[model samples]
Target: MDIAARSPIGTRLNGLAAALGDGLRTHGHWVRAAQWVVVLVYSVLIVVPAVLPLPDETAHVFTHLTVFSQFVFWGIWWPFVLLSMVLVGRVWCGVLCPEGALSEWVSGKGRNHAIPRWVRWGGWPFVAFVGTTVYGQMVSVYQYPKAVLLVLGGSTVAAMAIGYWYGREKRVWCKYLCPVNGVFNLMSKLAPLHYKVDADAWRASYGPQSALQNTPPCPANGAPNTARTVRIQPVNCAPLVAMRKMEGASDCHMCGRCSGHRDAIALTVRSPNTEVVALGGHLATGWQTLLILVGLLGIAIGAFQWTVNPHFGEAKQWLAEWLIDREVMWPFAENAPWWLLTNYPAQRDVFSWLDGGLLVTYILGMGLVMGVGLALPLAGATRLLGPWHTQRFYHLSQALIPLAGCGIFLGLSALTVNLLKHEGVPVYWVGDMRLLLLVGANLWTLALAQGVCQRYATSRSRRWLAQAALLPALALVNYQWALMFWIW
Candidate 1:
């Protein structure tokens, strides 16, 4: 009574913290019910319409967007989801992904074995991402429901199967092999808030078995029953992320399973660049750098850009002329089938062998061009910054996330802009919009690069020199983007 009376404010603060932590972790039946409702709605809206035939022109409210499914999936859903990852750190993955939920539900019914060794490889995420990306493009997954079923639906089935076989009541499929897993991991590092633990307090409250009753079970899924000398790992971490060593948001699914374990952890706010500027050196890899700089920035640019790119047209025309002189028919033959290209004859459109070849050339050429453009400068930065190594280079290269992310966003947004324009909505300011986005991305990248040099370089001169080395590559990326968005 004496202690309580003496420190009423402190006691109230402790009580408040406990309530906040509990609230953060709680996922009531209504929440689960809402998620199930979303899952059902997604299945109807996304998968069902993909199987239904493409709608007539009058059915299309937003011009050539053509179908409600396509419009909602691409026009509204994907663009905003990507933006949400930057702003909210994968709340979509943690809370609403139908595939993720299905996989977990199935795993609850299956063998519940430990994840295998091969599944734990770091490279699988990137490989899965590239495969998904390439396959989506090959099948024109966005425009066709059958393709969507084959691509997105098929992946969902695979995820459930993986969950059933590989882990106990967990999301092994997502943590290990989901195609967008790596992209999400990289993007999540830019999130503005995350649950952070105070290890000391956690250890104190749960240091022994006798303390168990005093420390309530987390009450979340797989919540700890009674605190004891805490194990080396968190018991309920579904994504299998090690809690103690979690300094960044990259591996966190933010499931809140660990919340209020010892009254030690809480949601905290920080800058989006917190991880990129601090722990990136250790987390970055050459593959990720290449994926961002070339795969996303280059090949993807061409994938999105080719339709509007006159250079692609000239190249295709030149090839057509050459083939005509020789009288070749293979280019005109739709021999490869619909799965390999856009071959919807009912729509009065199909991609011939020539179109497919040209697309491959465009994507590869852009990758080569933009990759070399960025790589040579990074090589130069490595030489100037010293202690040259691929890992070091890769780590330093991550400073481009801001620029790369912006490029990807703008590319996706072009689909939105195109649809709106076709619907007869005025979009005269799109060029200016692209310009603003590009400029913002460039500045953000430059600022991050300067931060990288400051944190990693040995001296002030080296920092400036490293930044100097980065400018040429950044300038080239911006120049090319300008060419795509404005000059061309």
Candidate 2:
């Protein structure tokens, strides 16, 4: 071991990591305790204000945006959750996710049906993500407490429903159907902490003993227990993470159920790109490419930027005028119920059909434009980098995951900052902070691009030229973000 790993603090941290992994694996009581606590706290927080009446705006006890539910949900929770993914991967999904917990708790009592092939579809996560994003906007989910209960609460219920019907084990809803699953999976790649498993050590230690009398031990004999810890069998991994092929932080939710099974898993610190760079074979897929392009780099940017962008008003007005000239006026009617759209006439808050249509077009058009901008450069990158084809193009697109990940974070953070500002909290430095983050994320993208090309491009010239091809995509994303924050 290196000097750093051997140091007292490092050793202590390692010990703690081992202990945490074991506890998560073996401490069934503790896990249930946490789930119930989350259930209680989140149930009250999400359900109460949504069902109850909103506080009277004129009755002034607190300042602007005194609605505690909205403040907590939007201002604090959303932004910090995104931040946590970057730092600790999907610890939220594994540990304190009330939705996941609820689903699992309900699923335990439900039938263990055979998982169908449709449930294993690769495009579900991407489709779900875009659907949720568009729907959330349509219903003003982030702005209203009731919308929160309606949308997020509906999702929580759906998770339970799906889990109740599908797979005998594993969080089927989380693994396949959750809108945020793909987002969390992508963001988790940037986390520095992961439980690394040595397959060789694992097999050597307990390959023969994998099937204990009562399924004792772990997945491949990894996650060795410490002296105070009793040897326990590894339980089924909830997210269905494969130990044999566990290469990145993408799939593991850090649940720790499989921590000390084969006595091979150990928590270790690494650079953020450890997984981004280590992802072998196919770097990404066409679906994944769409996710980064249309979803993250494109729609995410447009989603956060449209209201702030002056062009939105011009476009909306032009469309309105065109529709009026054509004598099609019904689209302007804001008659949709609040449950269907954002029609709270009492609060002077209603979204016309025109508004909903314009929003979809604006976001889709922005995404299409950005995706094209990226695709063209990436096409060049593929040609420069390899005996290129559709799959290779998809593979090479992984180079920009850093950029995509950052765009999503910034977009969400924008909403968070807005909520704080509404409550009269000072977020004066948000613009500058965004600029710094943009620059840092861009630099990280460039570095990752360089590394990817060097490792994959076969020759020195190809490596350099491939990186050159990726430059424009990086530049295109940076330009759009700059236009959003700095210029028109």
Candidate 3:
């Protein structure tokens, strides 16, 4: 039992957790109903805005559905959804995601085929995330309604199609293919709430049961006995997690379908560092590290910073000047379709081929540089810990989740700030808030690094040396953020 489970305050907390878990179990139908409601709203937001004309300079979020959808989708919905993953695991994926719900609903009545081995490939999350991030930048997914429909709506369609082809009643798309699945999985390791499974109870309940009924000879003992069947209803986990083996919140969607099964699983509280510091050495993988170091910290930062960075402007100008002097005119043409590149004429927001090419280059360049910069120190720390241990290297990478998650949140919330600023809202506190979050995230990550070091280091000196090796990576991350928030 957990030490906290013995105290009065802990007892109350446990009771609250149990009640919450039981409520979900009992009111699952209500959750389904709520999911449908969200689906309706999501559909309207995605579809209705695409058909409407683009909002003009005089148009406000309140006055125009297109602008309102932009604010809702980018400014509020996505940023808060990212925040929710760290707070409560993937409840959004389980209960409120229109795509997940729609995909599963379609899958229930569709062909229930065996999942192909290629479909089960583990690297899809990282590949899909990078693909979508780069493509979204190329098309300006955050700015235009058409781009939102293309990127987000297109993802929904693919989800349903994959569901139609894959395992019955399972979130195969989410488990393997969703663009944000890797991000959510990385951030969810820090969630305070998760479905806690009691392994001992699971073993006891699933063990062989002996019963006597009529007259059957027992083997070897020569006793008369009969076998009686005992049945327990199986849990239908849509994400297809093994309830008995689940140790972290990364894969479980928190749907509560298996809660209280055989008096074992329950929603419970835990330290946010528990998974990263303890289980990460065993569970961490190279792909997850790539998603953190490259995808989130590298690609995401570049995507958010390019528009605001003066270097992008200078580079584009230099390229344009060279192109003009060389008499190359095609790159200057804004003839690309809105579906391919951001070409919206009336709003005067169109990306020429030069713009699109440079955007991709800039984002990828940032990703490579930042990814290499961050990886070096982690690699150093890993080497300092001992001779090449791949698991320990990946485990140390887990310590950066707090900073990576915070950086992404801050980037998304920057859109929120820009949208509100356009609405004439005062946001004087945003700067201070950003600083506080950055400091807090850095401190949290440092503490997690220390805890992880404690697990691997054989001596006190070795531990301090390993931690010292990590300081450069922390400094690099802080410098990147400082450039965006302070220097820029």
Candidate 4:
């Protein structure tokens, strides 16, 4: 018998080990389940829609042309922008993002890549800093119509290309460049949910008695079952391993990857202590709930425009009447030539404000609200949901912020669609790119909201799987709304 040859006994043992890795392993189950969902949805919704065109070619043509032209020429107001900002300070990223879920599931097979201690500590502050600055300028650009189209349209193509080419390291577009991501991150403070670890449990799980404890090794590579490990810095090891270390590093995506190995679990707290235990899980605030509400509303409105009203004839007529009958009338007599009144200052002001500032003002104002308001709310819609403990006020506020924001935007969008439709203005994608940005931003909020809600109910492992499922679902919804005109 050759030693290298796998005989019956050897083959059996190998098969058993593989089975253990696939079946017994928590990560394996989560990843496989998520993958299955992705495959199912991709086939049912995405591929099917593309192959079988919608009956309304005129509408469908407008939709495709809209998406394409927006990507090329216009493209604006997407939900992910708000969601990215919201996730930055909230639980949305860990709870909602499909990519994060996929990464967590796949990470099970690979060793946890511990970012160098320095990088985890203070080295990567520039990532957030640069992201903030870029977002600020982008928000300003959205105020100008032409600038909105050019910048947003160009960025979308660039983001996809970058994601395909160089997304592995730096997560360049998702982590740093994409305006949508930036919005979630910025608005994260507004989210009501967070992933928090039990300090005591975290410490005990990753402590010296690795084999004896129920918890597995630290997923982020803390070297639990080691003896000859060298600690360069006091905070080099996980907080449990190194008592001096307090909270886990900020770069932690809070995917529950550490806990998914059955080593840790997510704990919800109304008022988390500021002590900051290193081995503990991530914390999400209530801000995300509000963000989600806002997002859903935005989606409803955006979809309505895509589906119900493809043109803005009514909007143009109303604007013209408002300008000609209301403002332009004062300048010229009833019998006077129309041209005399058409060139009036009031007319120019209306044109400049609407043509130039309308989209930009809305985008910038909304961005500011998402970024700042997410953090500002400590109290929220109480009567609407029902009064509760004062301690829960902060948490409640987080949930409402996104919801209210979504409603406001959605309402505005409906009005805009109706008004524009009445005015003879064709609702082309280039012109509606700003709305696209709004849609993307809101959808992201909804996903994050789902994650936050899930965190409150589900286990770490299950939540990870949920996150994986959300992304493809979003893509499906987007494709349907765009191609089939099923906005609802």
Candidate 5:
């Protein structure tokens, strides 16, 4: 019934999409094989590096296993994975994630108990993301293998344990507790491709007689009578998504498991802004808004900026002087173990109590400041459009996803540049590339804001007013990036 399905080109596209989906359904073993391959590579990258000696200053990624693992995990793997969410949704989560695979595998043979209410809490994604992000920063997870082991390895173990105790063959941890689930969900809203579900087709397929229309009678029924109807076997979605009701890419893992189910779902192309512009307002939540403004824009920036920010050093010095004047030295003298803090005496990397406290304070401080800063313009935009609507505010906030996602990508790719620099690889264009990405992201964000405003504002004048109120927010975001990439 779709317009695209009526034309020859559209028909070909649909055929390709159907083939892609049905192939996954019929040849599931291929997907399992791919999952195992990723799991094997992931195991080596996560486990092997943690036990190996730290790469020396002179070592290169190609020449050293430790450095290679670090490059692969932080530089190439994570940055590209984040980008992939925008390009093709959470294919990485469903197809290639070792933790998801392991969790689902363990879940298949475990107790298969009902999910606890607390485990299904809506705020878990936000809390888990913030917790893991802060903890990773505190322990310098990006730089140290022991810290990586404790953070990422520990997360894997917890995922498996949660699987063992929770739902049968489901990604319980990924659904509610994965540290990056909230982030991926937000980013995937911009993905150009997703599993599109046809509600009418699904309903038709579920009709009393439709399920038995094409199939032979079951042996249990003992006859092939046309009068009998049977229920269709349901798709066993690992993420436990309600396939027929799915409307957005935010939660769908893009595993293709439920694709073509009831002749409804199919992998389809769409505009990048389709999800946010069309459905964001209706589906937006306070937690997602907080995750965007506070978690990503605020805490993430602070975490990445602290190392390079001259202000952090200046503040640390001022505090150190004050503590010394009062003979308060313990905070400066004591450091936690590597698992708890970034302590590696041989590598001359250690975080004293003062360092740890200040780091947490700074990150949280950034979150509060940035959250309030971004929220003001959004609040203004919401009010400008009409009465103060919380949903409207959340909808407008979705426009910032492009900028927020871009900032995180830039921050992560900085690690890639740093690693390449260590290997004597010239990356002189990195700054130019960052600038282009920032500009493009800002433009994309503004365009999305315009699209959202059009939906809410009844008149051109009102829409313009709403957009005017959003400029300050965009400016604030840009200013933060300027500090990190240019001013600092």
Candidate 6:
């Protein structure tokens, strides 16, 4: 076959793959299957354990539900969280997240401009829902009885209201509110994935280069130019007639709705020669919802296990007894536990001081390490990629936030497993294997961030420093949380 003929064949194969992926997403019946699995687990793992007399159950999973709180608890959770974010890019927002899914279902695309009367009138109920749920945890309600109803009602009303409001614009709740979304928006820096726009193609499509001047009016009727967070310059569009006439054309979700094109790809390649996209309200991907959901699920499970397990104390006692009962190679070690207490009165105090001191030291040290790390790289990125106004630092920072969150998460997980083991907890404590996994994952995540960062900040030093800077901040944050436990 001629080379030209082969090129067309390759193009056709690529298009086929893109279409197949889109078909699966558009129909999304498989996602419904996934939902069923979630439902089954919710029933079997979450509800059953709650209602029935399970021996070791005590909301062991519920604590993990609070994604923000997990930052305070364990680091092992970070790698899984990173993996989910990279795979789906926020699928958690659409399908898996119970809250977002419920919001979407209730609001019914939220495009209508008219605000629902119930939401406008009953706003406080939504506030009450959040308050009551958090308060329930603080007060140790064990289970939310009437609180579930409150959640349902408030969600319905809020969905109607926010849905109506955002429907008039685009993803209003996700951009301005939705605490979980906010976390994703902020922590997305730690993510190993980023949205890439073909700048040359976009410029060909729309000539003017302002955020407002470049893209078309949102067909979804979302907010106009203000919604452009990612570089929506005229540089990245395919010059299709319909696309060429549109301003803010880069806000296209690559949903492939406008131009009859299917080139947008989720690549294994860490970086693409393209424009960096940001969380402008006008566009969202299928994966955003997914990441949020999976993370939430993990958080819920971790929380229940960590905070509320009824058998935790008993489990610790059994572990202590078993170790004491044995008389093998380390008999002297066995006797030392008793002797250390009797002979060395200051051992406990000394250990407490050591723990607290180490935690504080890590916090300060990690902070400095991250600050210097990122600054050096970021400065370097600017020096290497400079002269063009294209390398924007702020946008790069956003993409790396999630990865940074992951690094800190791993650091904390290590510390958490350490503390749990010390307390005689029977959980799988951190070891060489898990630590290696964390390091490898975070490094890949950092590379991805740097690739994206280079496009934004031309200074080589700045890029290098910024990329390196993130880890220490994460480490410091983790250390700060660990100190809280030690202090209390």
Q: Write the per-residue lDDT of candidate 1 for residues 1-488, one digit (tens) a residue.
A: 11223476645644564454456468535445766987897788766676566877566554332366676777778778777777767667767778888888888899988788898887777667656666677667777777877777788889999989977778898898888777777777777756666778766765574366465678786576765544443456667777766777778876666766555666555567777877787888776887777777787677777777788889888889999999997887876777778788898768888988787777778888998988999888877777777776887788888787788788788778866775678999988888887788788787778877776678889988988998988888887677778777
Model 1 misses residue 258 by how many Å?
Answer: 1.7
lDDT of 4 by residue, 63-175 (tens): 55332222222121233334343333323343344333343333334434443344233212333333333332333331222333334434544544444443232233444
Between 3 and 4, whose lDDT is larger?
3
TM-score per model over all chains:
0.87, 0.88, 0.94, 0.35, 0.95, 0.44
Off by over 4 Å in 2: 1-16, 26-28, 55-66, 206-232
List residue ranges in candidate 4 displaced over 4 A.
1-172, 182-193, 214-256, 260-262, 267-354, 357-404, 408-488
Report the number of the highest-TM-score candidate.
Answer: 5
Query: Candidate 4 — worst ten consecutive residues by lDDT sum?
Result: 272-281
Least well predicted 10-residue stretch by lDDT in candidate 6: 266-275
Clashing pairs in 5: none
Better of 2 and 5 by lDDT: 5
Each model's lDDT comes to 0.75, 0.76, 0.89, 0.36, 0.89, 0.38
Error of 2 at 184 (Å): 0.8
Of 1 and 3, the candidate ranking higher by TM-score: 3
The TM-score of predicted model 5 comes to: 0.95
TM-score attained by model 3: 0.94
Q: After superposition, which runs of candidate 1 have C-alpha atoms over 4 Å from their true positions?
A: 1-24, 62-66, 208-235, 324-328
- lDDT per residue for candidate 3 within 1-488, as digits (tens), equals 34246688766776788778888888999999999999999999999988988888888889999889999999999999999999999999998999999999998977988989988898998899999999998888998888999999999999999899888888889999999999999999999888998888776665544223223577789976545544676888998898889999999998888888877788888788988998998999999999889988899999988888988899999999999999999999999998899998877889999999999998898889989999999999888878879899899999999999999999999999989999999999999999999999999999999999998888889889989999899888888888888888
Ranking by TM-score: 5, 3, 2, 1, 6, 4
Model 5 per-residue lDDT tens digits across residues 394-446: 99999999999999999999999999898889999998999999999999999
Residue by residue across 41-85, what tens digits does model 6's lDDT show?
Answer: 433333333343322223333343322122221333334443454
Superposition TM-score, candidate 1 onto the true structure: 0.87
